[model samples]
Target: MTSVKSSAKAFVSEGALSEIVVKIMDDSVVEFLVGLGFVAVPGKEKETLSLIAPNQEFKVEVFSRLRDEGICFSVGPDWCPAEVFEFLRDQKKLTGFYRKIVWEGTSTPKIIENC
Candidate 1:
């Protein structure tokens, strides 16, 4: 995984209560996700983050930040908690959950979206 040396910008979701928007300052989001203890979903694109589960507090913190920031987006069903993710990881013998990040692809890479 890439190292997370640059700072991260957390954006509040405008409509979505479940998803949170975190602006990745570095070129890669993989590092940021790894730092958070979330892993990429198997058989899926690393960019298309999918985790086993995320707790309500974790969800709320992200969603709330995005909402507070006035970042608008489509809200979906509530995400499962971290415990659930842990269970699935243990049962399925999976590595970890996925964390999505949107890259700007500019000289100074900046994240556009985070899930």
Candidate 2:
């Protein structure tokens, strides 16, 4: 059977609709956090994440070692918060793109470019 993706119009519950809507607005928040170099793995329950950016260079350092975690998080102006991508790009430690290995079933994260 084919998988059904989540749609924008879908609602999980009537009573939780408002919160769900808010969550949708920040759907990419997790991805953005992950892209910044957090070891955000799937199947792990997470309520909140603290992105530790001690310096500008380490802002995106999370992505550098995240490949070992087998994570696939979203990014881009269309999918993620625009400011987030910009912040990650601003960090000299991080390259523009990193490999997504879990769904792609790869052993490495690809570096797209230098920011």
lDDT of each: 0.35, 0.32
For model 2, the superposed segments whose C-alpha errors exceed 4 Å read: 1-45, 76-92, 95-115
Predicted model with the maximum lDDT:
1
Clashes of 2: 4
Candidate 2 pairs with clashing backbones: 37-62, 37-63, 99-109, 99-110
Per-residue alpha-carbon lDDT of candidate 2 for residues 1-115, written as tens digits (9 for 90 to 100)? 2232322211111111111111122344556444544432234433334344565445344444432232223333333322343445465544544322111244332322222
Report the C-alpha lDDT of model 1 over 15-88, residue by residue, as the tens digit.
12333333323335555545554444455445334332255556544433333432322222354322333333
- Per TM-score, the best of the predicted structures is 1
